[model samples]
Target: MARTALALREAESAAGRLRSELAAGDEAATRSAGSRLAEQADVARRHSDGWGFAALTHLPVVGDDVDAVRRVARSVDVLGADALPPALGVLETVRGGGLRSEDGGIRLDTLASVSGPVTEAHDASTRADRAVAGVRSDRLVGPLSGPVADLQQQVQELDRSLGAAEKAVELLPAMLGAGDRREYLLVVQNNAEIRSTGGLPGSLSVLRAEDGRVELGKQGNASLFGLSADPVARLTPDEVDLYGRNVALDLRDTNLIPDFPRAASLMARFAEQRGQQVDGVVSVDPVTLAEVLRATGPVEAGGVRLDADNAPRLLLNEPYQRLRSNEEQDAYFQEVSRGILDALLSGQGDQLELVRVLSQAAQQRRFLVWSDSDDEQRRIEDTPIAAALPRDEGISPSVGLYLNDSTRAKIQYYLRYDADIRSLGCTAAGRQQVVAEMELRSDVPDDVARLTEFVTGDGTYARKGDDAMNLRLYAPTEGRLQALTVDGEPAGIKVGQDGDRQVSVLPLTLRPGESVRVRALFETRPGQIGDPSLQWTPSMEWGPTRATARNLCG
Candidate 1:
């Protein structure tokens, strides 16, 4: 028992050091720590396998405790022998700059080589988590019990980290085009000009990748493929009524679908009309781009040096003033897109930092991808990168509140919004009641009325300087709105149903420095406390600020 405990302590110590080394980008130290961890884990496994220890599981009263220890010992051994090594190997390759080769192509062969090991690591880590959970703390006693529990929790966390790392390694190759040359429509969404999924598809870039080399192809403004006045595909009554009569018009209205797969298909169809055959769509808002820039350093595009701090402003808003005509602005947009892609593919930046930033963006739903390949799509199906609203009844169901500029102008750049949801309690009928609030503020300067027509609209849809917005609030598929109020008064907004969600739309106008608050009460059909997640349009200067609610079911 003493030897087993000592081995666990040494193994945990090594894991902590390994994590620290990885974070600090010290490849040599990380490899050393991984080796030490494996040695300590072997020691623990051998000590735990003693004949006397195995017999303890057959003894009365303490049998379960002994079994729990045995489980944890096996888990640690598997983690050290099968999991950490493969994960460490991948990290080592990434740190050594093997993700991208000298010619700026991804190292596909190297990535594919690690996929088997990483997948195995993931499976082993999952088993480790089960083993740890099977431990029964009640049977343990005194000082040893506390230490054992702590060790169990530590091991669980380590397993989870390994699982995440392995998933990333296994997913990247397919995403970057492993077997065949892949073509995808890259949407550079401008949140300043709000749309459903995120923002207006201000510009589009074609991303082509083969083996491991990625190249950015032709780039153009979304408007270049002029709106197909008629629906490219059939639209539901609710979609037509809420979005418009034509599906083409809703190509920029992605958030309306909530499900990225449907949205990507529509966007792809729109691209097809303009002679672009894309296998999938990848969307990124300015905030996501800024996060990437934070890792890749500053990039020069159209004679402007864009860094993390000013990327949103320059990319989303400043174009209106920097260029004199819409044509010039479109060209500039293409140039910026090309420059950013060049910077990324040049492999001059910190690869680890890029991975970390992109992972965080995916977790936040800032970067989304949809592929036509069944296998590729399957890998990201449940992940945030898929950008699908959750429909699980037992888990937290998600609610989305999104905005689109009705004025057909770039005025959304001056808009800011905050959203929050609170759980009230479960109803007697087993439904969950939730209160959602969204506050929007327009900070456009009074002088903005004098700006060019490009900054405002043609003044037909709305006044030149005022902000006109169509706000859509969505409830879980099994949920319904109980009541709604705008600015302290009952609002008579249009309510409709789309897919499995209940939708409420409010059209409003806000002048410079004006703010409006909209609130609603809703109930989800039994067995669910709404997942505390609130989705909104990604903004240039302001991303959606959110507040979560406690689980009322508990």
Candidate 2:
């Protein structure tokens, strides 16, 4: 027992020296001591596994076996307790020298943080060594090898204690270390609308804003979007710590795997190693409050891909087609769909894809836009009616149209159709309603003047019992239509099919106030009649042609 106590004292003295060397920055000397300690610890562990501490109970005394065992047990415990102070002291000295920043910046470095875990692991290993040594010393000079059965019993007890200490030592390194060192990713989501209401939470501007800078100054101001917390600017350092304790008060704290100072150092080191500038921040969003958060990564590691344009495609698997609503479409591409499409079309041998959407201001008016690409330029071109019409194996038009003389800009090729109007989805008021349909296009420089001449001048024809057309515009008055008239005639008349509702119809051939029977003319059998003409009457309108259905009998 005396020899065992002297050996433990020597080990404690060596441990104290190693701790002092580490504190003095003599890592080489400390490492040498640590290596020797590891070797001794391994030997002690082996001895403990082989023989139980009860072996210590049986000192090398030729006395009653039970009495010797009790006496040895008490002495061995006293020696172990004395060894603990030095082991624990060494651990404290190394671990107390926490991270230090050479750069004098808030950002942390991994090297500094790494030193702590290394020190802790080394300390744990040293303690584990002392524990093993105490057990072994008790066994070496003790009367443990009494009976074969008694030796086995002592060996079992020593094995359990050694296993626990070894496990603790092994786990110490892992627990001391920090998590992944990288910049935190933040995600902000909002509605795409006429105006952006919400802004990013952790951006540099918001964090640096002074008091009252983010306030909504006026009553009924809809700009701020009802979110009003500035966690970054408002939280004090102590408050930040309280929040981070378990709740992770700051978003930045949650991003870090280790403590704050260590985490900061690690992030800075990671940035340096990767050849980039890295900043750390946390984010909060009231909009997506309930979703399980996923990491947003600026770094492209571990099969993570996130970008605004590309990210949406991951969720929507279908091929990208332009959406139909004009307001919605404009908001998405910032009203640059046309310019983008034009750029795509200017390339060599690239096909242009047109996405058709409805014009919001006018119902049934369609417009075509294209997606942006770096390829070709696309321009809207107008072709003659004869060539633009679908080809038939029959007689074609005789005259060739030239681009220089055509009214291309006046006639939009893509005419939008609204199902709601055409389908008459709304309930009708009576059995009798106006129903008229015509197909008319204009090439005149002034559509209103051309329409007026036909409607109120000597050009219109009307037939008795062949229902007349009526005019109705959604506008409050017909002042604009009247302004386009020459000599007292109104231009641009609106037309209805039959007379239960008022619609305007144009005249095919007639003087003012003339009455005649009306029939739509068609060249069914070409070159068959006089001047190749059939009985024709005119509508009162020269506006864009529309198909209308109405009930005439009242």
Candidate 3:
């Protein structure tokens, strides 16, 4: 027992030193420390897995503690022995040129060299994560709980990082035009006029990549073009039944559906019909562009000064009030987007910082990528940026509460949206009851009627300052909604299906200074004991500043 404890302590200390050595670019020291760390971890694992020590794991009260020790030792073993070497290799190769050559293009050889290493690290980390997750949370208490929980968190983070690296190594080559030139449609979703998947496809640009370098091309806005005569692509029956055919015919509403890849495909088809060649679709909101600004600093483009702080307002609301005509506003927004895209292509920032900011944006659903190629798309599945609607997947079932603005104006800019989901405990069979709640308030100014006619709806869809929004709540895959209420009163609900998942829809009209809270009580399927989360649409603000869900499964 003493030997095992000593070995684990030494192993952790050595691992910390190994990280420091690698960060300092001391390759020789890193390799030497890496061997020591692995050796110590193996020693601990051997002690824990030995027959004499394993015997305690079957003794009722001590069994949980012994098993916990065994899991921890094994977790550290895989991480040090299997995950560390490849991870070190990837870090070394990527650090060689900072992921970019002197020509401002990716180095294909560097990418190829890291792919195998990243994959090996990903697999090893995944196994380690599973082992840590198996710690008996119900039985492990007090001091044991804290370290085990911390280890679980660390392993989970490592798993996600390694998984992302593996995907990047496989996908970046083709996307960066390793051997072939690839053209992708860059669709900027505008949040002022809210749609389900972020917002309307307001600004459009084409990204051309050849020989590992990216270039901007063909800028326009959806408002500058008219709707298609025929559907851009055939929609699934459920999609049509839930979102209406306008999701396909109208260029702006193409993303009304929550399925991002499906939405990207429709927009890609629209671009293709207009004589544009597209290999994939990249989606970003102004908030994501603002994230890019973190490294690029402030940009002066198209008669506007844009920085990280004022980007959301400048891009989503200010234009509608400042520009004289729709054409002028569309042009202005497109130019702002082009400026940001150009700065990104020019690599005008620290490479590591840029990747971090972009990654954060992807987690918030402000940035997304979808490829038309099945193989490439598969690489992105299970990633934060995939942005696909949730289907029931074992323990972690998904719930959604998306919002869409029906008023044909920028009134949604003043709409503050938030959600709160509370887990109401589980049944004998493990079916969990949950209450999903959302509050939508109109923060429109008192003198909203005095605003520019263009900013307010031209009174065509609804009152000038009124917001017509459809709040859709989705039950977990294979789950069902039990009851729903609006402002503590029963309201008419339209229930529909988006694939196998059931959806409850509510329409609301909020005048200036008014607010409404909607609540949906639902239950999960049996054996669904996973923590719950609420997925919602991003409004003018891309990040979640409000609580979305609460887990009460204590």
Candidate 4:
């Protein structure tokens, strides 16, 4: 009862602190502080409640047990105010004697406690059922509050109770019918026997690293086995008498490693699925299964399908090896397979339609340039194989190019591989080829600005491993402008700048192995008085020298 009261107080204090912290500023400090405080508060409350219940088993009177349970239940009601009201009301209906009894025999109430080993285990089972029931109702309301919270609260209670009950049940059988029996107690201790260690023991065991101590029957054996005295000794009844408990080795602490329970559960599940008998493990009680179905939902058999009624149990007496039960498997299957099936199927269907539309847009943007090396400058210039293809609406695509000089020796160009598709149907592999080697250019007027944009790969650019592109800018007025600036951030290239005009070169040297993207931004004042228009032409100079129209949009 004291533990229960302490848990209630701690929970209340935590709630108050949480409310206050939430009302404070939403800064990182406040958020982290609030989270830590909430976690501490919850830990305190849970420990208080869990240890309080454990202490309740020591109660001498029946009235004390009832009072303690009621106190804990009331605290739960307070903590779970958003959910406990409706569940409490339901429990109250069956609280009275004979209210739920169908016949003269003993009948289980929705919420009732029973004494003794089996009865305590049953109590745990009942609480678990109550939790599942609360979760179901919480789902119906589309809110995981009130009843949902209550269910979660009940689960914690059941978890502790079940653990305690299982321990008591396992240990009780060993102690039962032992009428002052005293056998030869041999206490052989060695450091080598230690296998897996965790929790505080893992840390504290470091202190014992000195000389690897071994003791036998309270005697240190330094020369027993001839191999540095492998410790072995016989413990007399008188020497073991120091242990206050009637049991053997009461001084030794029990290892609370989590792997033991998990391994046991898995082994039990395997045995059940394989139709083998397993002893001293928690078997899936058929009665518990019925209660689970009543509180939760339909059950599934095998890995196939679910049935609303006639649920199957993955018992320790089955044909196949199972890691989890039918109920657990079913729950996990629903949880993991929620949206994945639709995503894969829909993505496959959209791939075909995207390829056709992009091909048509490629043809229109294809152009030829005049080469300076040959005497006839109008001679056929270099063009990609994809660009020279005949115009076929179902098979061709257009390509557009824009360039800006970013450095003294190089330039960057923005290439658009524009394709009109209603959806993203092209697979990543299918869209890879066309996106590479597409020309990109800037819309800005100033050469320096366009160069800056290209160097930074700003505005818009394709993220592809494609063939190289070349960039060049013509700036006759201003010799070589200062470095480019993209959105006011400096790029590396240095160029010359004058009023309303700027130019910067770029490193648009695309080798066979290198992949590159170019961006450019232009910033200039309006044209001078009587000037027809202020023009800045950023050109791409690689296989083809095509100048892009700049400042036209402005």
lDDT scores in order? 0.74, 0.24, 0.78, 0.26
State which candidate, 2 or 3, has the greater TM-score: 3
Evaluate candidate 4 by giving its C-alpha RMSD to the native, one decimal.
36.5
* Candidate 1 TM-score versus the reference: 0.77
> Stretches of candidate 2 above 4 Å error?
35-54, 58-554
Clash pairs for candidate 3: none
Q: What residue runs in model 4 are displaced by over 4 Å at the alpha carbon?
A: 1-121, 124-147, 159-163, 166-170, 180-554
Ranking by TM-score: 3, 1, 2, 4
Give residue 351's lDDT in candidate 3 (0 to 100). Answer: 57
TM values, all candidates = 0.77, 0.18, 0.84, 0.18
Best by TM-score: 3
Global local distance difference test of model 2: 0.24
Candidate 1 regions with alpha-carbon error over 4 angstroms: 1-89, 116-168, 223-226, 253-256, 393-395, 529-532, 541-548
lDDT of 4 by residue, 1-554 (tens): 34433443444444344323322312343344334434443544465356555675566643343333333344333333322223223223323332222322122222233224334434544554443332222222222124324333444433433343333333322222122211111111111111111100111000000111111111111111112111122333422232112111111211111112222222233323434332312111121222233323443344533321332222211111233343443343223222111221122222212111111111111111111123321122112101121111221121222232212111222222111111111223222011112223332223333233223233233222121222232222222222333334454653423221233434333322343333333222222111011111112211121211111111
How many residue pairs in model 1 have overlapping backbones? 5
> In model 2, what is the error at residue 176, expressed in angstroms?
19
lDDT tens readout by residue for model 1, 225-326: 537776666777877777766555646665556567777878888888878888889887778777778667999988899898888778777888778887
RMSD of each: 6.1, 38.4, 4.7, 36.5
**Candidate 2 lDDT, 1-554, residue by residue in tens:** 33333333334444455444543435456566545444433343333333453464355543234333333333333323333333344334334432212221111243343444444443533443433322322223342422212222222322322232233233322222234222221212111100011111111111111111111111111111212233222333432332233212232222112112222232233323434333331222211111111111111211333232343222111111234342432243221221222221221111110100101100110111111111210111111100111111222101100011011111111111111111111124221111112222322233233222212222233321111222122110110111222122444533332112111233222222233321111111121111110001111111111122111111
